[model samples]
Target chain A: MTLLVVHSRLGKHRFEVAKGLSVREALDITALRVRAACGGTGACGACVIHLVGGEVSAPTVAEYMKLGSDERAAGARLACQVRLKGDTEIRLDRPAPPSPWKSIPLENLKPLTHGLPELRAHTLGVAIDLGTTQIRVSLLDRRSGRRIATRRGPNPQGVFGADILNRLEAARANPAHAAELAKLVRTAILRAVRDILARDIGEVKAMLAEIGQVFIVGNTAMLALLGGRGADTLLDPANWQGAIDCRPHDVTPWRAKGALPCAELVMPDPVAGFVGSDLVADLLATGLTEGPAGALLLDIGTNTEIALWDGATLHVTSVAGGPAFEGSGIRHGMAAEPGAIDSVCSVENHYRWRTIGGGAPQGFCGSGLVDAIALLLADGRLKPSGRFASPPGPDGYPLDPNHPNTAITGPDIDAFQRAKAATAAAMSQLLIQAGMTWRELRRLCVCGAFGRTLHLGHAQAIGLLPAVHPGLIELHAEAALAGCEQALLSPGGVQCFDALTAKTKTINLSLLPGYEDRYIEHLRLRPIALTPTTGQRP
Target chain B: MLDRFIKAYNEAVFETDKEAAFTAVNTALAEGIPPEDIVFKIVIPAVEEMMSNITKDPDANLAQHFMTAQIAAEVTEKMLEKFEHPPEIIGRVVIGTAHGDLHSLGKRIVMGCLKALMVEATDLGVNVPAEKFVDEAIARDAQVIAMSAMMVHTATGEDGACKVRQILKERGLEQRFKLIVGGAPYRYDTELYQAVGADSWAPDGVNAARAIINLIQQVKHRDSAQDI
Candidate 1:
């Protein structure tokens, strides 16, 4: 056994683990949560740790790919990739706050259940936004249409693979993994429900007896995994039954039926294969379908769901934005947590940053990265083509040379570029497909937790978000949750969702003519080209 | 003799100067260096080096890779232009990113690399449906279909490579064209290529051309053997 000392804001702690135990394992034993977005595959570089004093195994090739020589020389390594050989004094990188992950604030949620009559006194409704990385649960009072409680947690299925493709691959390799993932989710959901009901078990039980139905909304892969049987159906495109066949199905029981004891676990119909019912929820939350014609809604997530409503038709598409926007793959990156840097400004050739809780900066979240890139582009420190104005030791652009711990490397930039390209290309392709220009759209609704807090100006300056009049952009935070709440409270909510899905013509961005040309064009990280006279953004 | 042309080509490609690259190739050809040697020795190695850099450094400039590919593609066009009679085209290829995958950078790079190899290539682009791949292949009389699926969205449904296999099998077009799957999704699992019912796979642009050529030759050999 060797003693490993870990230094963090939480205070230093010492642990004794058998020789050859990875730093990640040691941290886990200490009950510290480190971001291993790729589930410690070393592909995400998120598990970085600074080795103060220690004898450890040499860095692996995955480490070499993620860390620069300067970083390596400074004793930096991926905690997931490095094993302990002797007593080691190390510092854990930014760790997310302990579980029951923070939920959207009550004020941020807009419940559309207003004006509905009081329901049966004991009836309870659960609205869940089953995201790939995170799950958001909202427990509502059916009678008063009040949101009783909200719960959040890391999706337990992340153990299989953190992203959609990884989970799909896991399911394909072993069909049992699919059922296991679904069971994990069901168990997690049940645990969350217990946690929420734990507050006032007796009172909530009276309310729980009134539990009517659970409304679930998520991307196709997530819902498919949750359904358990659709695992095979999700693996190929030809099997896509389209939105008409994608109606909300009862997920009552797959493992041992009637497990939840709820009326049903119903998933709303998805807009298309890639564009899921979460988007339908987005549309409901934003009321875009009921809004004036020519409105555009973009819900950014692992799979960015885009919906544009012409005067008559609803066109939807999902852009695979990857996990960068969620702060998954970058060094010193985290979700929009308390210590997460949310924005950046340049001063004295150094980064001036703001964190979520105004605490010492731990790492950059999605918005901070967008701001950092915009600032770099504005100052000519980063090229539109993604070349650093000056190389930081032949790898990535240092966020601040003085702050060696905080920097965006080459791999980080590549990931960011790919994400930005996907967003921009999808937006452009949708517009061209609709035969409408950006200016023609009445409103651009930005939905999601990240979208709500994103630095819109900075996002536009970097060409990630299209340049438009600031007045036309709207932020709908936790729209999927809001949409779910609305559906449960409203009369004929399920049918309304189905109707919206049917009207939505999902355009495969890749299949659009000139999509390739536009995608390549947007891949260059530059300011959006605005028509001077018309003030239209592409 | 080929070293001089290789050096010149490297300089031009790294600088992203297409004209200079073309001039270097012309100069080498004018000096009695065979076009085949210029392509096989000079062009291939330069692309291979860029790919190698990209491998070691994930943050390596992908635009540079694309630029190098563009230069190689132009050189291939020029080489064919100089042929006294049109050189025999090795094969026709239809390439794309599987449906639901928005990634096109890798697909574009591969298309450029294939063009440089004197292959008649049509880029069907990203989010391509399986039927579209077959339709384009049939329309173009293509001998190979190359599909690039990103890791996060590599599933068969909603426009993935599995759909390509399903369509090919349904239409009895599986025996018609060689299939190759590549991208970050399948990098760790080559078995996925077989799982998706593809003939072969490559990790990057540099290896894709070689893989295609090998698959094509295998197809020819199998056909010739069956004839006996």
Candidate 2:
């Protein structure tokens, strides 16, 4: 046994662990929260800790790659890679205030479904928007058919992998990790439910006796991880035959044993391919599927999902947008939160910015990055080829000179470019395949917490979104959650989703002709040329 | 005449002038300096020099090397155009990035090198299924099938090298075409390449063309021996 002390802004704690256990394992045992974003693959260096005392194993190759010589000399080691050789004292840094992207506001949410009398008396309905990085939960009062309380928290699986690809890779590497990821998500949901109900395990269990239903909306990868299904097909792109198991699972047992009560937990069936029920929910919430056709729905995240309704059938595809949109891999990038720069503009050769809560800038969020890139391109500071004109400072362009900490690194710009290119490519491929022009689409519906704060002009300027009629662009915040709420409230909407899925044709963009040319063409951060469609309806 | 042509080719490459390099090759062809000799001696050496310089100096200008490769590819293409005998199609080959691997830079270079050698090469784009490689090979009557598995996770699947072999074995066409696998992942482990059922392996595009050519010859010799 070895005594180890960990110091953090959350305060210091001491632990005794068996010799040779990695620092990450020790932290996990003690329940000390730390980010191991690559799940101890050592690929993501989020688990860096300062070794203040005692002996530790030599830094792993990943640590050497991630940390500078000065950092290594200063006793910096990746916690996930360092196995304790002797009693050690380590320091953990405190993270910034939790980002607003963590929670979705359910204000002004109208009831889309009517209640069931028998179920209303006995059960409470819960709608969950299970995101890759964060989980948002909304509790519904069965009697009034109104949303009562909403709770949000980091998905515990985040420690394993920050992005879906990493998670899928982690699952492929170890079956046990796959099972653990699913268990962690279910546990997090239970924890969120308890927090929302403000009740103990016993009380929550008792309340479960009257459970109406639960709806989980997330990407296919998230659903597979939650539903405990083999996700090998999602990881291997070639293995994808354009079919996904859309059958909803009854996951009540996942939380039932943990002291929460749930009679039935129904995850809506996933859309074909990697587009999950979330898009199905997006379609329902945006009313895109209900209409006389020609509307596109794009929910941008780590994996940007784009759907185009061509009147008769739905065309859907997911682009490998990477984790830039979630602010995961960038140096000083973070989710939308207090102290996070939400927007950027250049005036008189100086960059100006706005923070989420107007505090000192800690980092740039997704929206701020989009705005910054657009502004940088507008000037000659950044090129359409995704290169900085002047040699970048240590962390590239600082949004504000006073706040050196809030800056976009050269690598950050590259990541942002790749993400935008993916989104643009998917949109173009979807439109081209459907034989529809941007003018033909009656409305372009953007949904997601990230989409809510996105500057439409900057997005269009960067070619992240096509140049469409300004009046036709609609933003729906937390539409996935709203879709889940609709599913829970109305049985009819669930049937509608079934019909939509039947008509939905998932297109593998790689298989399409001119896909490569279109993708390469859109890689440049330039607007798509819009032809004159004077007679087109806006 | 040969020495003068070599000097001109070297000068054109050093200056990174594609037009000058192409003209130098044209002059060499007009002087009766064999196209294959120019390719093996001048073009390959220039590309090899650039690669070695890059290795020796980490910060070496990559644009020069890319320009040289581009010029070499163009010169070979142009030389092929002027050939009277159509440079007897050495062999037909199909190449692509294996399933789950989307990287294309290496594949593009390798395909260019193969095309430069006057081999009929069909390129299936990145993220190609293993079946597509076999299907294309069968359709084109290709003598070699080369696949790049850039990432460790994407190198071999039941549908990749293994699947390619399975399809060949089922059709009893195992001796018809040679299989060569290249990429960063399989470079260090030749044994792993064999385990994945590849006939041979190359580290990158720089050496892949030579490996594929040799593998095809070996397959041809083996078929002749079996027939005898």
Candidate 3:
């Protein structure tokens, strides 16, 4: 075994692995979550981590192909590409570009100053997280590619009803109402832009010049409908949706799709349709292909998706989970914003939490959800079946009997169960298909905002986590977003996306057998020891 | 006694006639029996018998579950229309889908239960706008905005109901209405509900009707306390 030092943002996470093992092998031994999409065959850029120090072997074709002309200068070598002949020091960083269109930070550099109009060195672009439950926007300087300002408020379109499907249907039936929605987006975006312009520097026109790109990252329907493309059918000409084109995936047609009119459209290349570009972008940003340790990546949303990497193959599946994380499904839930309840605690058999706004108590966020599950499990309030032993004492939290949002309902438990089942089933199926089990895997890295706040123990308590030892499970905070930032770290990150398509398999979950049964079995909030009481709960 | 009656009827009658179960439940309710008593005692037992029958034969031509749902809806409508607006203050609310909620049966059940509970309410139906919720609240001044989210995916209109609330704020009507969301796909986490910025929620009809009145009074009481 050769000693290797794995440097991460949190300091040194080191390991000693066999010299015959690739560089990715040592990092994998350490706490750094580096995965080789091509099973160390050096086919995917996902396993690309930097050799920060120490003399390592030469780069492999996968690493060489993944890096751009600029990144090669900074000692950026793929973890799998190099062989270890001596003691090596490496830094764990994501490999390749989200796409060539996205990684070009040089082209994106703009020099905008305080104030709109007239002229500025750069432009301040706004990126909106237009979710079904909540909408958030981050303002970035187009020149420096830095987020100088950020703002989040409730999406004004909520009044029409709740959820995107409802919104889409409404828009489809009423074109004028759809336009009104667009006007609202324009007004809101303009207001934020204007406020920045007014407080900072130039007038609207001058400020506009500073923005090199306006990347609108969101779930698909949001981009489609908000861009006024919601009603577009395949047969329409000029299926224009008022788009603002930017090359995302860097595919030739992706660049052309940017030309197809959408309401301030940009690159949606990574993921679209029901899954949305946010997830696909997050996947690219996080680089799931780096791991072959039989890891699972789950991004929870209105539609929860799970993907598994089995050393040699990748399998993906989606489950119908609610907008629980966004706070829409809960009685008093809010977005993970300033006033939302981001964390929860259970003391003396009762649940308590600090709200986001930090005032009177309200609802929970994804983090709070983990804590709630933890607290509930600790107090024996929930079983794997997902039923609560009725909120403890008779002082009875004054719950709303009819309000499904305020109380734990069977369906609610069922939903959570299905979600867990989906994840567990996906994990199980992936492992089963790949001829292994989650327990057999050396490591399971949890990524995305949903997992960061979730307790691995609690997730397992509710059977959400696979039947693996707690020691094997680890959390990567904002791994996708962090991965996005990681993609930006060294030079040539944008141009390195070629390594992405080169290595990886997308396993569709529809083929799995025990999947449906596991899904049905998992549907019970608590594991059903006996037959579950369906109709109405007393 | 009620369960036995339902079981007997379902065995003797509904074995061949699929509609017999509904007829039996309706008959049980006509003798001044409570609806919960009807569901818990009669309907539930009858359903059990029907299921047993289906299991025993396996080839009995049972009408589709949705058809049964429609028939039940008709029965509920008939039962609800006969009440002629309860004289006492059971409670008053307006229930429906958001502007894009085309799924209406769940909303109907919500309405039926309110009527069953003798709570006076305006049935706003499905696919209502947030503006309509506001306008209707101002008009009917509804105590609770009871919304049944059938398709979990389509509960909220464009961006979901919260977007509507954001719209309400833009339109200067944030504090004017209270919101309550329910559906098969929904869960009850008060903070989750409030996180979406709604007043409250209920899981079932009995609880929902009572919760509506309770939340309404609480809001009014808080308002008066503030005024005082």
Candidate 4:
């Protein structure tokens, strides 16, 4: 057996493996997080590790293709391709800093005056928004329905991959991997619960004994993975439009494992397909269902979900917007954190940008990318067809001349185009299916972290959003979390969610006839036309 | 004047200038240029040249490639209406994304290019089953079956290209239809096509059109030789 030592920001982790075991596998066994955007196929070159000591097998063809000569010379190698020949020591450098949590707007949530049968004077309840990229938890006092504490952090399951599809593929491929993913998420939630209680209230066990219910909401794939079942069914495209059974066979063991005495663990069923309870929660929090029709809610993320309420029926569909919106798969893209460029504009033939926290520019976020493209289009530097007026250099167009390393490349624009196209096309299709138009939309609720900092005009100019009047648009950053909190505290919350699901009709965009044409038409970097006709430029 | 028109048309298509391209075509029509000649000599050659040039430019954007294919397809359809005699289509092809894959951009681009090249391309849409690929090809009398998969697992998954290849082998229709695959996974690993039992692969949509054309020719030649 060969001993492998790995060092990351978390701490030192050591593992024992047979010869020829790749570094990625060793790290996986140790449960140390590493970025494998291509699921460790060595295609993405994201799993880079520096060799500080010891020897490994020779570099692979994929490494040669992805890594520069200088990088290889500096001892950087793809962990997925190189195997251990003997005892080795390596450093996992450049770990992404954890994104800070957006404060949940408790004021926006409806006050829970009535309690459920399980609620008691000293009892508490937990509400969790299990997002693919981030997880937020809120602890509530069951009697008064007041939030005691809230915690949010990056989802630890991201080590498997950034997108839900990657994690679903990984879970479906191996049973052990599926179990590990479930355990990792469950443990993270338990730790957050413990941390919150330990900080505010004394006696962790006593506080745990006073908990009544733990309410959770997430996408279909996430809920399925957490239960360690129903993931394989999602792999087939035929089941994409049907309701997936995300409820676990049992939660007694999970609760027992965490040593919680909650009376019940409530995970409301995900609506049909990838439309999770999160969107249902968003609708509930925003009151879109109760409003008089012509209201649209778009919760944009890696998997963007759209809900159009056209008076009688609520049409919902999920589009795989990819990771471009969340700042993955770009040349110099990062999450909406400090140092991330969150806004950009052209000033006097030069570009000016601002970071999230007024810090030095690191890379572009989704909003910043939209602003840059929109400004470029207005300046005639970039055409509506997505080509540069003058061909860019090898490094591509630099957003800031001072920070040449932070630039947008040709592939970045392509990624953004595909993402925005998918989103814009889905919006159009949903409207058409509902026999409505953009002008009919009286209320447009944009939900998610990306929409929070997004400039409405810039988003519309780049065709990411429709050319609707700015007055109709509203940005809700923590709608999902607020919905989860409302459900956790209200007496009729479960019934409300059930009612919303009953009315939703999921339109599978892939199966639609003219969806492809609409997608291609919206691929251009211009405002989506107000009309529903194809091949018409705005 | 015809030479100048061809140059202007090629440049317009290369720059994705739709209005300019249509104007150039209309001008050629006014000058007594045959519609068939406009398609065969101007549009087809321009598409071929743009694709060839794209191969040389490392920074070629997909939007440029997509527009080139779209413009070519639009021009060809317009000119085909004015052909003195019905121009003969080279062949037929059935294309789609493999089962469990929802990506349609690559497939759509390939279909556009094939149509511009005078191939009757039938789109099966996305998440197409393996049997569907074979059935559609046989139904349409297509000479080639093309599949696109953007992810690694889908490219090599049991329900994807491998299943199509398996069905073709079982039915002994291997010689009747040629298999071609393209997408990101195939571009990452050139040998992946063989592993998935594909006859050939292309890195992008423009090259994919050229590859499918060659495969169709090979299928036709095989049928003729067998007949002999």
- Give the true-contact fraction for every prediction, in order: 0.16, 0.13, 0.00, 0.44
DockQ of 4: 0.26
lDDT of 4 at A188: 82
Query: What lDDT does candidate 2 reach at residue A292?
Result: 57
Q: Which residue runs of candidate 1 sit more than 4 Å off their true CA positions?
A: A1-101, A111-115, A172-175, A200-204, A244-264, A401-405, A531-538, B1-105, B122-181, B189-201, B210-228
Q: Could you tell me the lDDT of residue A325 within candidate 4? A: 86
Q: Residue A116, candidate 1: how far off, in angstroms? A: 3.6
lDDT per residue, candidate 1, A472-512, as tens digits?
88987788988888888886768768878877887876555
Candidate 1, DockQ score (0 to 1): 0.12
Two-chain DockQ for each candidate model: 0.12, 0.09, 0.04, 0.26
How do the candidates rank by TM-score, highest first?
4, 1, 2, 3
Q: Per-residue alpha-carbon lDDT of model 3 for A55-166, expressed as tens digits? A: 6677666666789857877877767668787777887655222210111111112232323333243344455555555444445654444554433345667777766655
Docking class of 2: incorrect
- Clashing residue pairs in candidate 1 are A119-A143, A122-A210, A235-B156, A235-B157, A236-B156, A236-B157, A237-B156, A237-B157, A237-B158, B99-B159
For candidate 2, write residues A1-538 as lDDT tens digits: 7877888887767665668878876654233545644446587677788999888898788998999999999988888788999989999884323332222332324454566454535557788889898787877766567665566678888887676766877777788987788888887887677554431122455565555567788888888788666577677665454556633364455545544454466766677547878888888888887775778998888878889998888899887776888787778888775567878877898888877644568888888889988998898787665656684755577767788866777678767766777787788778877887777878889886465778889989988878887788887777888888877777563686787778888887766645544554455667865652222211
lDDT of each residue in A1-538, candidate 4, tens digit only? 6777778888776655567778865554223535554435577777899988887999999999999999999999998888999989999985423323332333333455555556555468888889898888888886676776666767889999987878988898899999888988888887777755653453477788788778889898889999888878877777878778887787865668445765477888888767899999999889997886899999988899999999889999989887888888888888765567888877889899977544468898888888888888889888777877886867879977789756878778878888898899999999999999888999999987574778899899889988888989988877887788888778776787888999999998888878877777777888888876675421
lDDT of 1 by residue, B1-228 (tens): 778788888888766556578789888988998877777788867776766676687446655565567677767766766566666677888988887655676777777777766677898866687889889999998888898887545634445677778888888988778889888857777687887778889877766876887777776677778899
The per-prediction i-RMS, to one decimal, reads 5.5, 8.6, 14.6, 3.1
Query: If chain B of candidate 2 is superposed on the true chain B, what is its TM-score?
Result: 0.81
